[model samples]
Each structure stands twice: as C-alpha cells, then as structure tokens.
Target chain A: MKRGTLKSRLAPVALLAGLLLALPGAPLRAAELDAEQQARYQTLINELRCLVCQNQTIADSNAPLAADLRQQVETQIRAGRSDAEIKRYLTDRYGDFVLYRPPFKAKTWLLWGGPFVVLLIALGVALRFVRARRAAPAATAVDAAALRQVLADEAGDDARRPPENRS
Target chain B: MRLRYLVPALVLIGLVVLFAVGLRHDPREVPSPLIGKPAPAFSLAVLGAPQQTYTLADLKGRPVLVNFFASWCAACRVEHPFLMQLAAQGVEIVGVDYKDTDADGADWLARHGNPYRTVIADPQGAMGLDWGVYGAPETFVLDTAGTIVYKQIGPLSEAVWRERVAPLLQGAKP
Candidate 1:
C-alpha cells in the first residue's frame, strides 16, 4: 500500500506487485533510515532472491534466511556501502542466482534473448499464414438468381402433374 | 512438406525440451560459486567451550567436511545418524551450528549424540552468511589445499556419502 516512497523500487510493476501481494505481514527490520537511504534499502531487498524459498525475493519471503538477508542489506546500507558493493558481496558468496536479474553472460544468453527468439518465430509463422492466404485462389461465385428460378420451375412442374398423371 | 511448414512444430518441440530440462533441474540446490575457490575464513567459538576457537586454517592440508546445521532445522536430524557413522570411520566433520541458540544447539547435539569433530557455534549466522548459507543441512567438502570442491545443499544420505563424498575425499591428496 505504501507506494509513494517506493516508486523506484516498484519499477518492475508485475514482479513487484505479485511479490508485494504475497508479502506476509510487515518486513523483518524496520531499521531507521532517511528517505533516500530507505529507497535504496527497499530496492536491494526487493531484487535479491530469498535462497531458502528459491521463488520469492527476500522482500516477499517469510523465511528466517530472508530476514537475515534483509537485515544484512540494512546493515550494509548504514555502513555507507554502495548498492553495487552490497550486491557484489552477496553474488560473490551466493553466485549470480542470488540476484533476481541474471547477469547477461554466455550462460544466460538464451534466457536474455529467449523472448525475442520466440517472438521472431511467431512473427514468421504469422507472416507465412498471411502470405499463403494471399496466394490461394478464390472460389467461384454461385448464380443465386438462376438457382431460385430453376427451383421455382421444378415446383410448378411437379404441381401441374395430376395424381395418376404424375406417376 | 516445405521447411517452413515444419518450423513452427520444430520450435514447439524445442520449447518443450527446454522446459523439460528446467523441470529436471532442482531449484533448491543453488550451484555454489565457492566451488574451486578457497573456503571462507572463519573464527568462531566452539560450542560448549566458548574460550576455544576454531578457524578455517586448522582444517587446511586435510580433506574436511564442513556441515551447516541448526537444532531448528528438521533435515539436519535426518542426517545426524549418518554423520555419526562417517565420524566413526575417522571422517573429520566440522559442524557449524547455524543461527541457533546456544542452549537448543547444545541440547539437540547432546540428545542426538555428537558426530562432529568440532562443533562451532554460529549463533548470529554471520558465519553462515559469510559461507553463503541459505538453509541448514548444507555440507561443503574442502580439498587438501583448502579449496571448496563440492557442496551438498540438503541432508546427506548414505548413498551420497558412499558414492560422491567418499570418492572426493579419496581423491583429495592426503
């Protein structure tokens, strides 16, 4: 609900919104921080993975490990450590998996480019469908007026025949 | 018949194969970056004897097993007996009581029987964080050179010890 001070932290709307909805109770440490420092603190915790749960970020998880990680972030912030330094400290120990954003490296080339690859393939398929439809010959139109006249004449001829004569 | 007709089907299969691989991979087991790197240096008081301290340097030049555990963790209980078996066979295991109270940790070990060569109290879990521990029952195998070689994320089973760990310890230059 407190989105005013946390706009920067909530930049990735869908990820943060889902995480915040799942966020249980208040966060672990409401460590005293100024406006700018608090914003920085929120950003770090929100982005860092809670390794215990594996799915939830430290900001959303109720795991004790998440709490400890949050506390660590706050402590580092108070110590005047930069955001990059704090992140590097964690990634150094926990690997790049600890960060929600996987680093754009050789190993993650697929992960980074996968969506666009899928999109391109889909576009190609769509284009092919459109082109195939364009190339296909159209069907000949039916003569509706002639068809109605023929049916009417058939009905009249059938009526003109008497019961014995019709046989 | 044409290659373009098969492209979408091929893409669909590729997606399925990628997802299947992801499914097979265990998310709980985070691949440790510390592997092939020297173990993090730590100096913590030994459980039940705060006066004495154990450090990473003490375990150098020998294959060592550093186990992260807590009385609060259920999985640690599962591996306790197996750990005792390893210790009986002269395996030196260093137990780090991660993020647990002194009373509970000591009591739990006393009840279960101590299997560790040296049980260090990591009350605040600062050492655990330094070791990049997110959960209990994590085990790390250090080579003779003090480089972390293997890390097991959960409770040890007899099979894991017999197959993976025992072989690594043998390969470790004594």
Candidate 2:
C-alpha cells in the first residue's frame, strides 16, 4: 500500500540517548581475550535493535529472529569483526533500523538535529521576549476619571493663583 | 499577540498531522533494503523433494514471487489460500519454509494444499538472514532480471495482489 509516508521521527530525545550509546569506542581483542570479548558481546547486543520486537534490543528480545540475530552477532564477534563492521553487516540487510542508535546520515539528519533546532527556536523566541521587555516601559492603564480629577484640581489651583503666576 | 498564540497552535497542528499520518503505518513492517537489489544467492532442496533444488540464479529469466513461510507462523496460514489462487493463475512462486523442520513443512503444505511450484526448507533460517527476513510471511517479487522489485512484509492479501503486485509484474505503476 502506498500509504502517505509521514514519519513522526519526532523523538530526538531518544536519538540523544542512542547517540551516547553509538559513539565509537576502542577495538576489541580478536576472539581470544575472553573477558573483554564477552564485554564487547554485551555492548554489541545491547546496541543492536531487534526488528521483530521494534523497541527491544536483541539482548532484551525473546523473538526467534532476535535470537538468531544475537547468534549471528556472537559468531561475528568471535570472528573478530569490529563494532562498526558488525553494525554495517546488519544495516546492509535490515537498513539502519536494526541499529538502536541511528547513524548520522542524510535520511536521519532531521532526527538527530530536530532537538537542537527546537532549542534554537525556543532560545530565539526567549531572547526576543527578553529584549522587548528591556526596551519598553510598562504601560500602566490610566483611569479616565482619575485623569479628569487631576486636570480639574490643576485648573482650580490655576484659578486660585494670580493671572501672572498662571501665565 | 495573536501570532504568539498562533505559533504554538500551528506547531500543535503540525504535530497532530504528523502523528495522524504516522498512525496509518504498520511500524512492524520494515521496508526491506533488498528491494531494487538482486535477490540473495541460495540453493536449497525442495521441502518434501530433497533430490531437486532451486537457486537465485535459476529464477533469473522471468518474474517470480519468493515467499518465506513456516509451519509455526499463523500469519502464513491466512495468506495461503490467496497464494494458491496465484499459483492456479500460473504465478511462479518459490516457497521457502523459514526455520521449519521438513516433516512439519511438508505435512503443513500437504494438508493446506501446496501452493508453491517448489518448496524449499530453511530450518536454520540462515537464508532468511541473507534475504533480510525478520519474520515469517514475507514476500519478495523479482523482475525478469532477478532484481528484487518489491518486498511485502506481512500477509499478501488479494487487494495487495491486485493493486500492487499485479501491476508491477506487468511493468506498470500500482
């Protein structure tokens, strides 16, 4: 179905979280260092999203496909593939959706940049509001009757005074 | 003053429009990256008939529909009859039973009335990985050149067959 495609990739909040997770890190030992390789396994699985369960990472999902993908990831890790290479393997088949952390690419520019854009707009509006407040004095409402009373009192005072003084 | 209210209101409208449009989409249905690329290479024996085999290279001369199904997948059952209908109409379909035992797959097809021209077994689903299959009941349509023209993530209903797949098979836009 050629449904009208309107992606509400509105959550740059999630993107920010994913960004921290996706940041490049040190290389792993080639299938030998058991402890660090296991650590790397944990990190890789956590970062890779399960396509079947959309929200859950492969580490977290019980879906058969997720399990299979997890196995694939582990196999590749033991083969000494780098994290980026492993991610590339998935993104090749599944597109960028398999990564919990989306890559900074053409399609995802809005997703990564949307929060900062909103922040800038908000900051611009606040700056304009602050400058406007600083530039103008508060216009207090002047009651018409109070203005008339003041005028009448001044006039009466003028009448009571001598002609030269009034002039 | 009105513009101040109007700005937020416009932003709210934009959000509503976006979410409303988003609601119509099936999020689970991931569009395959394999589309517009050649179908993945594989050679697996037909489900019941192990002596015979099918491969991606063999499917090159004409348009074909490659469907991945399994005995365990309930969604595949829903689309089985329509697939049979297509088969009756001489639509060349290659059925790959993803992560299914040959015994169960053959029995399922026999009971359900085999719709496939040839049925292949993918007990481990390694070929599923190659084809970018995340779930069962995924279908891929290949052009005469064997390039994957389109991929249907879920069930292939008659409406989808008529509206989308049929036209594309004829080299026209749906």
Which 10 successive residues of model 2 chain B have the least lDDT summed?
B165-174
- Candidate 1 has an fnat equal to 0.74
Taking the tens digit of each residue's C-alpha lDDT, what string does model 2 give over B39-147?
A: 8899888787788887878888888889999999999999999999899888889899999999999889889998887788899999999899998899999998889
Docking class of 1: medium
| TM-score (C-alpha) between model 1 and the true structure | 0.81
Number of the top DockQ candidate: 1
Model 1, runs deviating above 4 Å: A1-24, A27-30, A138-167, B2-16
lDDT for B126 (candidate 1): 92
TM-score of 2: 0.79
C-alpha positional error of residue B91 in candidate 2 after TM-score superposition, expressed in Å: 0.4
Clashes of each: 0, 0
lDDT of 1 by residue, B31-62 (tens): 99899899999999999999999898988988
Instruction: Evaluate residue A155 in candidate 1 and report its C-alpha lDDT on the 0 to 100 scale.
Output: 81
Q: What is the fnat score of candidate 2? A: 0.68
